[model samples]
Target: MNKKRGQQSVVFSIPPILKATAAIAGPMEGEGLLAGYYDQVMEDDLAGYDNWEKCESYMMEQAVTTAVKKSGHFMMDIDFLLAGDLLNQLIATNFAMRSLGRPYLGLYGACSTMAESLMIGAMLLDGGFGNKVVATVSSHHNTAERQYRYPTELGVQRPLVAQWTVTAAGAVVMENGTDGPKVTAATIGKIIDAGIKDPNTMGPAMAPAAVDTIWQHIQDIGREPAYYDMIYTGDLGKVGKELVIRLFREKGIDISRNYEDCGCMIYREDQDIHSGASGCASSAAVLCAYLYPQLAAGKLKKILFVGTGSLHSQTSYQQKESIPCIAHAIAVEV
Candidate 1:
C-alpha cells in the first residue's frame, strides 16, 4: 500500500490511466515530421488571433476541448485541470482556463511542464483528491522568442545550438480507468545548475538535470535501462541527448539505443530548426499524438518520459546568472 519508492520518486497504488489526449500544432510544426500524428494543425500561427500570445491561449483551449471530446466526457466530468505555459504569469494558460471554466491549478516548470502536470495529476487521482484530471501545456514560437530572447522581426541570426520554441499545445485526460497507458511512477528532479549561462544552449544546460532524475528513478524503482522500450527526454535536442548517453555510460548504463529526445523527434533536418524543439509543447505534442497511439496499440510496453526545463528568465540572463535546469520523470505502461 505504501507507494513511496525512494528519494523523490513514487509508485502509485492506484495508477491513473491516460484516457485520451489531443494535440495541436502551428504551421511550422505542422510542416514538421510528426505532422500526421497531431489532431489539428493550424494553417497559421495566429489561428485568427490578433497576437501570438492569444494564439497560444487559443491553442491550449483547442487542445483541452479536443482531449475532453476524445475521452467521451463532458466538461463537467473533469474534476480538475492542470496546465502551464512559457508566457509570463502563465497568460496562455490563464486565458484558456477562463474558457475551460473548470477548477484549475496553474503550473510553471518552463519546458518541463507537461511531465510536471502529469505527475501532479496522477498524485491527485491516486491520493483520492480527484477522479478525473486534465493535464496540459502550451508554447508559442513568437511569444517565447520575444519574451525570452529577441523579437522575431529582428531576424536575429540564431546559433546552431539554439532550439526553436514549438508553436503548439497538448492535453491529456487522466481518469480512474483501464483503457490507456497508466501512470505508474514518477521521479521529481531538483534544480541543477552546471553554470551554463547561454540561453540559446538550453539542451546542454538541462542534460545534467535529466541525467540526475533518470539515475534517481532507476535507483528508486530498481529498474535497469533496458526495462523500458524507450526512454524519452523532453526537448533535450541532439546535444543534450548525446550528453545524457555519455553521462549514463559513465555510470555503467547504456541508454543510447533505447533513448530519444522529443526535441530531435519533432523537427526535420531541412526545417532549419537549429538544434531542435524546446517548449512545453515539444514533449506534450510528441507524447500525446505519437507515443500514446504506440502505447495503446501495444507497440510500446513501457517507457520513461523525462521533461527537461531550463529555468532561466530574461532578467536572470540579463543579470548574467547561470541557467538552472530541472527534469521530472514519469513511468508509463500499457
Candidate 2:
C-alpha cells in the first residue's frame, strides 16, 4: 500500500505478488483549481439540460480513454465491459459504454460500482469468458442531486461531512493470462441499517453497511486483516471510517494498522476541504490513478479496496427517517 503517499513506500511485501493490472480513474479537485470543462458543463441549465448527465457521460468516456492510454490498449480490443453509476437510471454509464460499442454487462452499486464491476470483470476474464475486459464507475454532484436528493437550483449548504459526488470518472482494463489476484473468492453484501436520523449526516447512515460487508468478508473467508497487505474502504470519510475501525476491533479483528479509508486519505482539511471525501469516483480515481502507478512500480503487493455507498431514497428523507447503506469490497493483488 502507499502509506505516507509521495514520501516513500512505508511497508514492504513479498515480491512478484501479481502481474495482471491496469488504471482507469481521474481527479476533479485541486488547490485553487476547478477542472474547467466541468464548470462549464455544470453551469449549463440549458435546454432544461442536466449537467450531471453530461458529467456521467464524460466520466465513462474519460475512463475508457484512460484505460486505453494507460495499458497501451485500444477500445475495440476490449472483449467485454462491466460498468455502472449511482443514478435513478443507469444512463451515464450505459451511454458512455454505448459510444465504445463494446459488449458489456451493465451494473450499479452506487459508489461501490467500480469494485463491483472489477470483481465481475476479473471473474469473467479469469474464467475464460474473454481475453480482455474493461470496468468503470461514475457519479456526479450535479446529476445525482437532481435525481436523488435535490434539484440544482436549491444550492443549500451540504453537511460538513457530506461527500462530494466526485466530479470525475474511473475505469480499468483487465487482461487475462497475467499474474494478479486470481479472482479467487468473493462475498456479496446485503444492505444494512443503523437508523440514523439526519439526512445530512451520511457518515452515520453508511457506517452499518460498511461494517456489514467487512464482517461478511472476514466470516466467509475466515481471514484476518494480516492476510492482506492493505484493507481500504471507499469514501467512508472520517466519521464512518472511525466507526468501522471501532466496530471491527470489537470483533477481534484489527484493520487499523494497515487499513485506510479512501475518503480520508485523498484530501487535507487545511486544503479547503472538510471531513475528507465525497463522490462515487473517490475510490475509483485513487485505485486507477495512484494505486495502479504504485503497483506497476512494485510498491503494493496486495490490496483489498472496498467501495461504500448510502442507499437512502427520497421518500425516506421526506419521512424524516434513516438511510440504508450498502458496501462491496474487492481484493486486488499485485
Candidate number achieving the greatest lDDT relative to the actual structure: 1
Query: How well is each residue in 63-129 modelled by candidate 1, as lDDT tens digits?
Result: 9999999999999999999999998999999999998899999999999999999999999999999
How many backbone clashes are present in model 1? 0
Q: For candidate 2, lDDT tens digit of each residue in 25-74? A: 22434321222212122223221435548656765776677666656677
In model 1, what are the clashing residue pairs, if there are any?
A: none
Candidate 1 Cα misplacement greater than 4 A, ranges: none
Predicted structure 1: lDDT? 0.95
TM-score to true structure, per model: 0.99, 0.82
Residue-pair clashes per candidate = 0, 6
